[model samples]
Target: MDNATAKNIREGLKADCTKCFGLCCTALNIVASSDFPINKPAGIPCVNLQNDYGCQIHSHLRNKGFKGCTVFDCLGAGQVVSQVTFKGQSWRENPKIREKMFRVFPIMEQIYEMIAYTAEALSYDIPYALSDKLSAQLKEMQSLTKLDAEQLLSLDLVMYRLPLNKLLTETSKYIRESLIAKLPGTKNSKNYNHERADWIGKKLRGKDLRAINFRGAYLIAADMRNTDLRSVDFIGADLRDANLMGANLSTSMFLTQMQINSAKGDINTILPTHIERPSHWIN
Candidate 1:
């Protein structure tokens, strides 16, 4: 796909709350933990969710003990579910559709996430065949987002997710080899148990971790201060509470807004152009 098309796809994957019905806050269940302070069942609106679909605690979710809310990103699935799948009628307007809408919300979220990853893969300077495959998959997934509520609920997410995951891994390998293959002490991100004993509190200071495969790694609270994170593949990595103070992530692949929200960073942290430094981060 062309850069313009890729840009459009990326833009479409962002959550636009104004066009949404606060589906993430309502449709998904929340377990009481460090991430949340309350147990809320699925299909139930959060106590802080207002009638207009805005969060009553939007500005103070973290301070109000709702860290999970801050970290959840629907990747533009909310609006598509609210506006497209349901034809712009919210469950509030048509109360009969409430249960169905709730069920479709999470399913649509997975589809959008797959589309987001495929689009990201297409943005790379990879081989023509790989780009073609990614572009085709991106189109197929984009079409899936337009499916009706019942259609979405019937989907086997693994079918789509598995192929996308494989393609992303291939893209990661290419990017990693081209950038850091010759570097000494290069680490394999998937070899978590053998290489790194644990996830939290890992202080990888002064590490040349370029083009590392951090996909699906649990990096909760891993200290990454002053690290150059360029060419890092962060797809599916658990970045919750990971310290990124002064870390450079300008060229990191598959890093999402939700991951950024989950992590701790500072003003000195260099993020991608599309990712804004969280205001809640240390200044």
Candidate 2:
């Protein structure tokens, strides 16, 4: 696929809550914690949901101890389930379909998440061979999203995701190796290992952290200004209050909306095109 097509697909996968029926608030269970004010079971409507399918405490979610809600992104799965899967019929109106809708929402969510990741991989300036493979995989994944509800439930997404994940991994490897080769010297390259390290309050300015495994690392209050973070896997990374000023993360992988929401950044923090800077970030 061309860059424009890839961009369009990525944009379409973004969450549009206005077109959804508050599926995240209902389909996913929330445990009482620092992030959530109360415990809510799966399939039960959150107490904050309004009659019109809007969050009554959306603007004040974090203030009211529901910071988890502020970071949640359904990746357009909510709308797909609300409109395409059920033909715009809500659980409230069709109580009979509520159970099925809840069951299908999570499956669609996994599909859309893969779609987002594959589309992002296709946008990278990789070799023609890799790009062609990614394009084919992207087309296949997008086709699955159009499947009927029954087909979606029966579909083996794990089978589909395995190969796509392989492609993404290879793409990340190529980008990281390329970036590392361009670094100034061996000392700089040798000093670039921060994978799963305790980096709290550590100054990591201008570091070449491409393809580093930061999954579940504690990076709270670290200085990460002007860091080259391309292809880094940030799944489950705790970035709360980490300084990301002027950091280039446009090519980062597995960096979810929730991770970005938890971090602190300034206007200069360069992020992936699909992600928006949190409003709480410094201007």
Best by lDDT: 1
What lDDT is reached at residue 20 by model 2? 87
Give per-residue CA lDDT, model 2, range 148-244, as digits (tens): 8788889988899889878876877776667777766763546444557788988989987766767568898889999988878675578877888
Candidate 1 residue spans exceeding 4 A from truth: 181-197
For every model shown, what is its TM-score relative to the native structure? Answer: 0.92, 0.88
lDDT of 1 by residue, 212-236 (tens): 6787787888888888889888887
lDDT of 1 at 279: 74
Error of model 1, residue 135, in angstroms: 0.9
Worst-scoring 10-residue span by lDDT in model 2: 186-195
Off by over 4 Å in 2: 187-206, 210-226, 235-241
lDDT of 1: 0.83
Clashes of each: 0, 0
